[model samples]
Target: MKPVSELLKKRAAAVRSVAPESTVFDALHLLAEYDVGALVVMQDGKLQGIFSERDYTRKIALQGRDSRHTTVREVMTPSVLVVRPDSDVRECMSLMSQRKIRHLPVVDGDRVTGMISIRDLMDDIIADDEMTIAQLQSYIYG
Candidate 1:
């Protein structure tokens, strides 16, 4: 099984983040601009939590809270599920499925490295399957 570090190398290494004290509205704008479903909540160069569109909808809009006044920390998921660089991709998939979460932060020690989504894993799996099928076809025809 491939490790998350390999997957991280295949894509951009930058992990977008916002300060915990930032307003939900600001975080929303960052999400829109990045076209991502979630953003890592950072405070003092540390991973504080995770803020996603779901948090905004469920915690802010549903609660009738003002996005401009509400802090990202207030609506963010405080207890985030994180993965390590050496973690297997399959394990990450299982965790996401069991937890019903869409995103995970890749951490190496205390530093946040990258972020991966369900879509990323699914795409990688599909690609690997395709490669295997192609190799099988080549061997059969040889």
Candidate 2:
């Protein structure tokens, strides 16, 4: 099984984040520019919450709130589900599934190290499975 720490290390460890006081419009801009679905909300270098496209759609758009004027703290998901860098990808997947969350922030001690998305986990799993199958085939033939 691939550990989240390995996956994060192989991929970029950079995680996009915004201040809690930042406007939702700013978060949206970051999300679009980074081609990411979510942003970690930080306050003084501490993880505050998470803001995602889902929050915008369900909390802002549904309520007809102005993204430009509203702060991310107003619409962000404040529960802030997090996982350790050494955690297994399967555990992360299960936590996300149970919470119905798409993104999880990875922490190393008290510091935010990286972030993982459901799509990222899925892609890794698919690639790993393919590699395993290929190795098995080679073993049988050789």
Candidate 3:
């Protein structure tokens, strides 16, 4: 039952972000450049919202809005779901599943420390399962 802090330690510390006032096209560019599906929308060094590919497709493209002219704040998910460093990984996974969300910002106090995706949680779970199986095998053989 590893906490999310352990997972964050294993990942790159840099959290890719964009300003709320930034154009959707610019945010999309950042997303492509970072090779990520989402970007944290920040304002005054605080978490404002989250901009994701799903937001782009449903809010911008589907609405026939111009990405070059539309602001990220206009399409970003403003009501973000956040977690803390000490939060359990399993709990985060359950929240993501129930909410049908892919990304969650890891906030400690007022600062955003990192972001975790469903993929990250799933990978950790798989690794944990493998380790448990190996330990069981070793104990049985010994």
**Better by TM-score, candidate 2 or 1:** 1
Clashing pairs in 3: none
Per-residue lDDT of candidate 2, residues 34-110 (tens digit): 99999999888899999999999999999999999999998898989899988899888889999999999998888
Q: What is the lDDT of residue 72 in candidate 2?
A: 96
Best by lDDT: 3
What TM-score would candidate 3 get against the native?
Answer: 0.97
Per-residue lDDT tens digits for candidate 3, residues 1-142, read: 7889999999899989999999999999999999999999999999999999999999999999999999999999999999999999999999999999999999999999999999999999999999999999999998
Off by over 4 Å in 1: none
Worst 10 residues of 1 by lDDT: 5-14
lDDT of 1 by residue, 1-142 (tens): 9998999999877899999999999999999999999999998889999999999999999999999999998889999999999999889999999999999999999999999999999998889999999999999997
Question: Which segments of model 2 are wrong by more than 4 Å?
Answer: none
* Candidates' C-alpha lDDT: 0.95, 0.90, 0.96
Work out the TM-score per prediction. Answer: 0.97, 0.95, 0.97
Clash number by candidate, in order: 0, 0, 0
